[model samples]
Target chain A: MKNPIDNLNKVFDSRIRLGVMSVLLVNEEINFNDLKDLLQLTDGNLASHLSHLEENGFIKVRKGFIGRKTNTTYSITKAGEKAFKDHLAGLENMIKSIK
Target chain B: MRSKEESLDALQDIRKMMERSSRFISLSGWSGISAGICALLGAWFGYGVLARTGGESVSASSRTSQVGLSSMGEIQQLLLIGRLTFAAAAVSAFIFTYIRSKKNAIPMWGLTAKRLLINTMVPMIVGGLVILRMMQTGYYDLVGSCSLVFYGLALVNASKYTLNEIRYLGYAELALGLIDLWQRGYGLLFWALGFGVLHIIYGTMMWWKYERVQSK
Candidate 1:
């Protein structure tokens, strides 16, 4: 099995990165730590994935301060949204073909 | 500020967020506006029907017009104004949401027509019948609450196809209905809560969480 997630497979293949993108796709903006908790990834792992996505123009990273601690938030870009939606559509088509 | 690998990693994280949240975009402003219009119009027609008759005690089958200065008359007049006010607020809110959607360049009525019809018809038809029943019985007092309750039910039932916030809106209406059922005389407060205040609150939330946030 080539994995139906093949063509749909993200250009960035790490499960952690895919997971992070998936979360940002839905929420308008999510903080770094909240993403950390949701994905159960280490601080280093999450940060690496975020950097990748932001570089790809798939997401936008905003930095600000909440109280004293610096807050970093992530949101999906149009290209990112398109990629995700196409992936789902591809998966659905694959499922239909299997049936 | 970061190495090539670090930059790649950040972009990947952003992509992952986009993927996860894509399925649940915020409701089109038009949807809220359309719903508001439907609600206002429904309220108008429902309240008007009641005005032609009288109180909950009045027989539904009777066509007798009750326009005198009796208690029913006073109540009817108050409710008439309330319904009009509700219609105005909803219409204005609808306009506000619609204009915002257009301004943001979100596709208006991009929804498939068939789904839109089914979603619009179910609650509306059911609500229409309910309103008619209320009118016949002259449950004019219950008219305001009934509108809110039925409208909420519509939103809850049809929420699968559209905005999830609508379901919350329905729950709010149901709450208002229960409050109204508990106290029969305070129609104005319930109207304000259900039609006026609730819309503003829900609209603001929708705008804040989905609209004003300006997702990249």
Candidate 2:
């Protein structure tokens, strides 16, 4: 078997990106405020990480207006879902094989 | 290159973050609120049962001796009511909890939830036994206090597996049970306060914290 490390995606190496992917994979969509609260991260840090995931085509971002205020939401793209699952499976295999 | 331990830790962290719940608690707030309502209703029915049976001591004496149709099988009736109330509460709470878990796409009976259930059930099963024994020996006065204390212990023990909010509720239950122990003849009152009122208050807070707040 090929090394599982070789199958892992580098994007998920960062804890924040991994967290965002994990949440989006489970939830249909999560708004910016709730996501921020869940992760307990500042707006700037979360935004940068969110943008990084968006750039990799691993997540979809949507901006809309909820009444007067602008609402930003995020969800995992199809590619993201597959990539994340693969990364997680790879990590599991890596742990089992390495251990 | 990370070691095996670090990789495993990351996997665990991913699961925790994915839950959309507090680090420990997988149980939802809606369950708490509904359970409280059921408890209140049960207490009301229980109180009505006692009032109709000429109260506890009178019913106890009637149980031993031959009496008219007044006190016939009061304990059995009360026990049946208790069982039904427990069943209703459990079913309703399960429904609400299942809905929340489904919306979150979290498996209801996953390993973490199983651990929570096991931690909660241990003290509860033991308490059920103690309660049954008390009823068999006719130490009826201590029944309410025992139930409260045991339930509190169960909640506290399971707090490590669930939300920390349960710990405070457990403490409240312990305090109420002790007071009931000190002053007997008010089991139903204490039961109502502990399980009914306290559950509603705490459940609302939990719902607000986890559900309403999150929806925003």
Candidate 3:
């Protein structure tokens, strides 16, 4: 199989997105605002990154009402999880090969 | 009435804030160093207390072995020292955190303190009372494990108010408690691992990832 990192959609390639992915991978599900605060990114910037990841089908975004307030929660899709794991493996391999 | 668009925008803003807040920033590096120092000192004191009081008498492989805290001849002094050392280390962490916050204009004490106190105290107080009752009833055997279990409960219960790192700490403590439940008689070692090693590991990780880079 091709190295998963080789096929990593550069669509979700930014540092913030990578960070968001890492956090989401560890946590079962996280809301949109929590991701922004954790990453310390502005609203528009986070929105754009989320939009990009959503477009790539790497993340599933849900919009619903949370206690009379509209809530948006994001979770990693199966594809996203596989991609992340593969990405980490590929990065490890690349690092090992570097030396 | 406010327009639907305005409400949607506001909700969007709240969501953004929540995401930003969700990332867990670990305890400062100094906090780890302080906690480790506390744990070691506490252990050393504990050892000394036990030694002076004729030391902790653990039978070779007993699960429900009694802890000989009553024979305080050599152990009393050691216990005193351990208590002092642990107290000092905890105080140092508080002081260090306070100083850092003051220098950075971060509000460390008020809300964080309130939350931590609520988290640390509720279960801790209840656990402390229970342990005291147990000890009075000659159940010194269960004190150590109770400490671990209640401490974990405190962390888990209070994890919602502040940084998510606390939740992990809670889980680690819970693991330690389970280890205690088996009553393998490795009391001191488990205490050190749970209170000392874990803090240092978490602290160092936090320092490396966030504080170090920011201060640079």
Best by DockQ: 2
Query: DockQ of each model against the real complex?
Result: 0.14, 0.23, 0.04
lDDT of each: 0.61, 0.80, 0.65
lDDT-based ranking: 2, 3, 1
Please give each candidate's TM-score: 0.48, 0.62, 0.56
Question: In model 1, which regions exceed 4 Å deviation?
Answer: A1-99, B1-83, B112-117
lDDT of 3 by residue, B1-216 (tens): 223343344334434434333432233567767887688767756655444544344311132245444553333454465567667877887776676656555445443355467767899899989977875675555667777889889878877755567678889988987877686656767777778787777777666765786687
lDDT of 3 by residue, A12-69 (tens): 4455667767767756777776666556678899999889888878899989888999
On a 0 to 1 TM-score scale, where does candidate 2 land against the true structure? 0.62
lDDT of 2 by residue, B1-216 (tens): 977887898899898887543333546787877888888898888778777866763223324344436644766777787788789889988998888777776656654566688889999999999999987777777877888999999989888767778899999999999888887557778887888888888888888887886667
Best by TM-score: 2
Q: What would you estimate as the lDDT of candidate 2?
A: 0.80
- The candidate, 1 or 3, that scores higher on DockQ is 1
Best candidate (score: lDDT): 2
User: Candidate 2 chain A, which ten residues in sequence have the lowest lDDT sum?
Assistant: A31-40
lDDT of 1 by residue, B27-115 (tens): 44444544454454544555455556553532212222443456455556545665565566556655655565456444334332234
